[model samples]
Target: MIKDKPIFSVKNVCIDFKVGGKNILSKRSVLRALNDITFDLYKGETLAIVGESGCGKSTICRTAMRFHSPTQGEMTFEGKNIHKLKKDELKNYRQKAQMVFQDPFSSLNPLHSIYYHLERPMKLYHNFSKTERIEKMNEYLELVGLVPAKEQGEKYPHELSGGQRQRAYLARVLSVGADIVFADEPTSMLDVSIRLGILNMMNDLKHKLGKSFIYITHDIATARYVSDRIIVLYAGHMVEWGDVNKVIINPRHPYTKLLIAAAADPEREGKVELPIVRNQESEVTVWTPDSKGCPFRLRCPVAKSECAEEFVNAKQVSENQFIRCIHD
Candidate 1:
């Protein structure tokens, strides 16, 4: 995968949202959603962003999709900085990189047909005639396994199941000739049985379509299934990242171990001992820039006083492993 250089790269990206406050001291304060996130997306590779719920997985997705510009650092697409792209350049960039949102129900327009959703992007990106666009729309519908392509395309968002809606949204992404896809927890809202289908489709897209994907999810099992490399995120910071199998088999960071332990394993016998983490907040925006040390220190079982004094950068464990812990 590294032979053909990275198609996209996020260099020390940081995102901060200015939220309203109740007290005078908290007035117009910045909440860091993503902190110094850095990664490279090679062609036809699926990079999974694994994290606990509300750990700002979506924030990374939105930032890469250009929904939220980074407060610091830059996002480079094809070696060109995305944030500096002009209007037309940005439009072209958007055509190449698309987002499959987490909420499939709300991602598509309720008033429009699935065919319309597919056609709009094709119309914008390709200067095809109406008939040609219609043909391509049907092709995309069938491409995502929406059989009886014309029939499925003619139906509205509400007319389809949650899985079908998600497929339709993906088809729309492919319709625009997207080379890089940011799937922000695409299967989180779907039923357990149905999620496998979506994951299979993504794997097929990754290998078959030769598309680079950023698969964000809280499920480590799904992450291992669909992704080539995995980045374990905690409180908006990347605690561990490496080859999927490497990280899954031997999790180094406390947070990564906890996340992997949290997964459902039918084969494992006896009661599992999960991490005894407490005083954890669902929304981790309270973790600030000035707040020293590791974010997981408060809850980490092996954290020391130094973990509270200053932050530690990710330590390289192997050729394909990295972890952000005070220990070796």
Candidate 2:
């Protein structure tokens, strides 16, 4: 069961990337990828970050994994500052936190067998004898539903189907003894029939192994299926966040409503017309660093004059829900 205390916390985080110089002699311009993002991941629970492409969903995973450092704010893992960890502390931190990439095919080494992939992490993190390692490897493979574990071990990455490859990745995560896993679109590439199985495995890992998870995806339906909490990101800003069911059932942010609407059944009759909130020019530059008001005002149907005058902070709308709109 998940406790009330947070296992991981990201506070007032901001990330900017230097794209290119405007001209030969001009200084390089910066693009803000994330702005003032804050959230927490509790033990044995999954926190899903949901948004459309380029909305900073993956950036949250990257920042949390320390693949990229933020320009502002701090991240803490079990009360320790993540960015300020010493060399040994950093190494130990890496062992505790692992990532499951979006593409299973690209994540694994095509040249190596499944056994080799699982063995390497165990070799780095534990002092298991060859016999013990072999036993544990087979155990984890079986745990992930890869039956006939010994036979699966000898097969190379290319020999497995997409679902099998993803299962191997999950087994590898277990081998490393990761307390937290950042799953970046882990099922996007798999067949629809197999996606739920991968998700169910993740749920099992959370409950059975006491592992915390951050599941990033563009699909709200999947996010709702697997997460305890859901955060809606738009143009690097958090628009709506709360318990997954609360936010999904009573979406307060305009952008979030549009997202839910967009994900609704397309073939159903009496389809609600998605509001066109942005002009052509506004659509071109989705990320605006100089905007004084809400980052989503440009696309919010109910935005007012005050929304254009200053940025709004998140306010508690219910016992477990928060919205970043002044009107809410």
Best by lDDT: 2
TM per candidate comes to 0.94, 0.95
Q: Stretches of candidate 2 above 4 Å error?
A: 22-27, 266-269, 284-289
Q: Candidate 1: which pairs clash?
A: none
10 residues in a row with least lDDT, candidate 2: 282-291
Off by over 4 Å in 1: 22-26, 277-285
lDDT of each residue in 1-328, candidate 2, tens digit only: 5778888999999898887787898777678889899998989999999987898888888887888898899899988889899998888889898899989999999999999999999999999999999999999999899989999999999999999999999999999989999999999999999999999999888888889999999889899999999999888988889999999888988888899888866676896899867676557334546656787777778879898887777899987899899886
Per residue, candidate 1 scores C-alpha lDDT tens digits across 42-115 of 99999999887767899887877778899999999989899889898899899989888889999999999998
Q: Model 2: which residue pairs collide?
A: none
